[model samples]
Target: MTMTTDTRPRTAVQLQTNGMGDLVWHAEYFRCIAEQSQGGQVTVIAAPTTMARDLIGHEPWLREVIDFDRRPRNGRRGRHSGLDGLMRMGAELAPKRLDRMVMFSDHPGRAVIVCWRAGIRTKLGYGATWLQRLLLTKAPRIAMYDGPPVTGTYLDATAFAIAQGFCSAPLVPHINVRPDALARMRERLAAWSQPGFALSIGSSEPFKQWGAENFAELAARLARTGAGVLLVGGPSETALAQAITAGIASELRPQVLSLTDAPVADTVAAMSLMRACIGNDTGATNIAAAVGTPAWVLMGARPPLMHDPSRMKMLEGASLADISPAAVEAQVLAGLA
Candidate 1:
């Protein structure tokens, strides 16, 4: 549906309760809102996960980041707890008296309720559900096709908001790393004056992860070229990182450094410093791309077209194992060059 730009709101809230990759995808959406509002206040209502905090907490465009703790509490955990949590969240938000709301989540029923109860006059989101179509003041229909980029699906909501005159700017996904973080990363890696590459080996699911052996071989190949390798991931993947680190030959081990469980800001800063990044189709890879670092993403299960296309070289197969180490090494070498 076409919408005329009318009723510029003074304050707007965005609802995004997904993972880090999704947060990176919505960075453009958030920027569009800020631009259209002409610096009007914007807030993000996100989940309480560490990834959410890391992705949205430091955004300069957002005025606040509210942690919408949806985990079942007070014996309220059940199949119906989602609705219960929504009502409670709405009650909590009603006091804010927001002027507008934009939702990026697929589950819009609860968000629609929240906007209504919060007394937000203008609501915008994807009309994927019955409640969404009935409750949202302006919701653009999203059709899922086989080959469309997932980033396109995300950007469509921004386009809708812009078309409606809620915001007036093009979508640009951005990440702002503090100078101190960048300085610290440089200080830590100063010992290795040569250019470096980031190796991200973790994914939200095991199916999406390329085998550790493959990563080990790739790291060995990169190390042979005298490029420092930074193994990146969360604490949960420490074991995997160690295994990959151990797999590298002793002569090349000095060039491979494991940076497991680093802060998101530091990780992003480190990625920015790298010549290029290679990893599974994971949030860290997305973060790397957002920071202007070229990434070679290994894809499994999902199609390559589902992700952002710019500054990325995707290697897809039926499984991560199907992507051989030699193919990844060639791409890595080309990316580094």
Candidate 2:
């Protein structure tokens, strides 16, 4: 088989900061860009978050992770505020001499302006706004309401490069787990008699979360089957984790563990160690799916397109409370099987 190849110029990708799930999908976009760039260095310009660093920092194809501060820095009247900050960012990036820039954000007019001021010749992004078209050298036609999943649209943004025979690798989110981290996760799970399942019971928004009682029921059921449950979430979810932990029967309580305060990287390592995951639509669930764990995500009112259904079992309803524990358990068992 003859493999086509194209060595493109250095590329930079500007990503959105909607949430961790969005970051995970954007990481996949980075992978596609890297693979498609041939040997060219690829840099990721994104919000400074541990999630962003952990997702793509270790990829060999990644040259750098530029921290793009979205907040009002240097005070209200400082040069780092508003349009001035965008210009400053452009000035800093100008030295890098980026050849082409890809914007994965919807309202990236400022970013497009930054790229233009930075002397980047080619700017590719998705948007129908006049400013988007006027600023971007290659603004592709996109329908936000009647389009594929957000991730799919992100992939489409790179269609020009792919068509030029620059990318052939399968488009999937890739996150490398450090060996030491993996070892620590294994040590932590050493007491488990069987494979463990990660249960994520928290969401950034309260409405996105399924009832804690539902998670407790699912945990108890999994415990009955001899599978240990690892409760995972951020610090804000400590209360919810405790509620689920306390709901488990006294005997089964030993099989459940909570790491709500663990670092994002450690959580990713732990997710990779788990046999599968069952959770509400959140960053942790997205990480589980991205790390190759079979994730059964509870999709409440959020659009199903926000997630990658092909990588996990998505149980969608008008609301998170509408999805019963039994339905989730069935999907979890199927994934484990």
Candidate 3:
């Protein structure tokens, strides 16, 4: 896509999510907007759990990342939920003087109103709801988004950006593994003989998990090949990581490393160091794909989601349990070869 020489305008993207995969997709869109706008950095308002700042803070084109804590936790109102919170957020944002604001999805409905309250004139979004359409100064026609949740918003956002002259073409989703992150992981893995393969084992839902037995078997197989298996996930997956490691043969257990404690950036760095990543369709898998690692996502319970074909490959089956370790091992080994 040819670069535009139009005057760069102050822009902000609003996405409400706690998921890291969603955050990565949105960050790619942010970079696209920045590149097309003559290298103008764009601000992002995202959910805190997404760690938008920590993940892409190193990017020169990222103006800032504002944490949007509107998701209800334990049935209680979030810090930025309800009428008072919205006003507070709007007041907080008013100082930025954003020329344009982009909102993804119709949920919360507060983002558009907040932008309006913050006096952001040029607003862009899907405008699925009547109120959202009324508030959005520029938006695509109302339509159902039938694509995968993780990548759909990014596609929609890029399409909207192009339509509004914010960008030229759709930018492929990518993650630039931070140098510091890489160094940190390198130091952490210095003891291991091989960077080997990574297993992204954590899933937001129970149905998405490929089960401990499957991952353990895959880890054992990889270890047999003299490959160190890195189990990547959040703290919640520690027990599962332990179980998978335990299930491995006693002699091969040391080859399996648990990286559930590593932060998002470090996890991405770890994936960068790996030969390939085989795991559930989760945020960690998305990170691996974005970092240009060959990610074999186990998509057994659902259809293949949108992903960069060059970096992500789907291994589909009737169910998560049905996707055998043997089949996955064969593909991963072949890919490495």
Best of the candidates, TM-score:
3
Query: Each prediction's TM-score against the native?
Result: 0.86, 0.84, 0.91
132-199 per-residue lDDT for model 3 (tens digits): 67767845554645676646666666666566565677666687988998999999999995958999
Q: Give lDDT per model, in order.
A: 0.73, 0.74, 0.80
Better of 1 and 2 by TM-score: 1
Per residue, candidate 2 scores C-alpha lDDT tens digits across 11-71 of: 8988756466767766655766776564645888876643576666767878888877765
RMSD (Å) of each candidate, 1 decimal: 4.9, 4.9, 3.8
**CA lDDT, candidate 3, residue 55:** 81
lDDT per residue as tens, model 1, 1-337: 5443545564555555456776776776676676555244477776555365566566667777776666533455533247766777777777766677777655666677777667777777666667667777754565433244546545565555565565576444557776777899989999973688898888877677787888999988888988899999988889999999889999999999989867887888899999888898778888898888888888754656434567777887677777888888886676666
Clashes of each: 1, 0, 0
Best candidate, lDDT: 3
**Candidate 3: residue 58 lDDT (0-100):** 88
